[model samples]
Target: MKFRSSLCLRRTAAALAALSIAGSAFAFADDDARRAILDLRETVKAIQADLSVSKNAQMQLMTEINRLKEQNRHLTGQVEELYNALEMEKRSTRDLFGSLDSRVEAFEPQTVVINGESVTVDPKEKQAFDEAVLHLQDRQYKQAENGFKRFAAEWPKSPYRPDALFWWGTAAFALEHYKTVISTQNQLLREYPKNPRAADAMLLVGSAQAASGNLKAARATFQKVQKTYPDSEAAVTAKARLASLGK
Candidate 1:
């Protein structure tokens, strides 16, 4: 009975030691779980911080992009404005040059055909010559005579001289300026014998002499016209005048 009591006490002491070891192990496991939880919480906090920094950077980048887009739009508008201004300047320059060229042309010489020949004449000179011819066409006899006289005096070497002289003689004849007609027509015949108006001029001189009662001189003049221009209209008129003088 004493051995049985001793064995039972020994088993009770061993059970107490095992229970103490199990308590110590459980305490160590709880400390490990707490450390693991703290590490996981720190990792999550670090990840959140990184995400915040990234979001801020992304927002700043978007702001910068928007600013750059606005700047580009402003630059584009300025470029378009410059292009339009350049185009307007070009057109203005072109128009100015066009007007200047036209003004310059007004003072420049122009080429014209006169009496089957090309001649270069000043604009002012052409205007004067045209005005004189217009006076003749209007049958303003005194004005025509004065205009032709001025044209002959001002442009003596002009190709239109022969026509001007002949018209002067015609105007003088219409005014019954017999001496003027005789002198003018004679001058034309002497200076431009081969002129297109030569036959007509000689016919006019012959008629003037007849009107002045110089039949002998008139007859000789008409005969000369018929001989000088046999196939001309002046020659036909001269023949009729000669027949009338003979009667």
Candidate 2:
């Protein structure tokens, strides 16, 4: 009976030691699990922070790109406006130059008709002739005579020669220069016989001769005029003059 009691006591002590070791192992495992859970939570928080920072950076970059695009569009519109303004200025300049050119051309000399014939006269020539004729119209006899003489000498081949000679003779007669009248009238008759002023020139010569006290010569000229231009107005005047001269 004592041996059985001793064996039962030894078995009880062994079971109590096994129970204490199992309790220590279970405590250590629980501490390890808590540490692992804490480490996982810290790692998740770091990952979330990194993602937020990346999102912010991406948004900033997108905003910058959009701003650059808007600025580019504004600059493009400004460039186009400048180009259009330049084009309009160029067109206006061209139009102004064209108008100026046309105005300049208008002052140039051109062909015109004189005495039923087409002729090209210089601008200066026309102006000078008109001024000389204006002097005659103003009864400036001396100036008309001098101007007509100069015109005859300078423009001998001009279509105005016949008219100039006729007016020169008339001016001379007005100034009582009978010798110059006769000479000028003779020149008109000799040079431009087919001119419409030829008969008038002959009549002027006869009148100048009569004024110069050459009655015989004057009567002969009047008779010649009546013979040469039988149906002309000068012939009728010559007939009246001859009748007055008692021839």
Question: lDDT per prediction?
Answer: 0.91, 0.89
Count clashing residue pairs per candidate: 0, 0
Q: After superposition, how far is residue 203 of candidate 1 from its true place, in Å?
A: 1.2
The superposed Cα distance between candidate 1 and the true structure at residue 130, in angstroms, equals: 1.5
Q: Candidate 1: how large is its RMSD?
A: 9.0
Q: CA shift at 160, candidate 2, in angstroms?
A: 0.6
Compute the lDDT of residue 118 as modeled in candidate 2. 84
Question: What is candidate 1's local distance difference test score?
Answer: 0.91
lDDT of 1 at 131: 82
Q: Considering only N, C-alpha and C atoms within 3 Å, which residue pairs clash in candidate 1? A: none
Summarize candidate 1's per-residue lDDT along 1-247 as a digit string, tens digits: 9999999999999999999999999999999999999999999999999999999999999999999999999999999999999999999999999999988978998899977889898777777778878887898889888988898899887777888889898988988887788888898999999988999999999999998899999999999999999989999999999999999
Candidate 2's displacement at residue 247, Å, is 8.1
Candidate 1 ranges beyond 4 A from true positions = 1-102
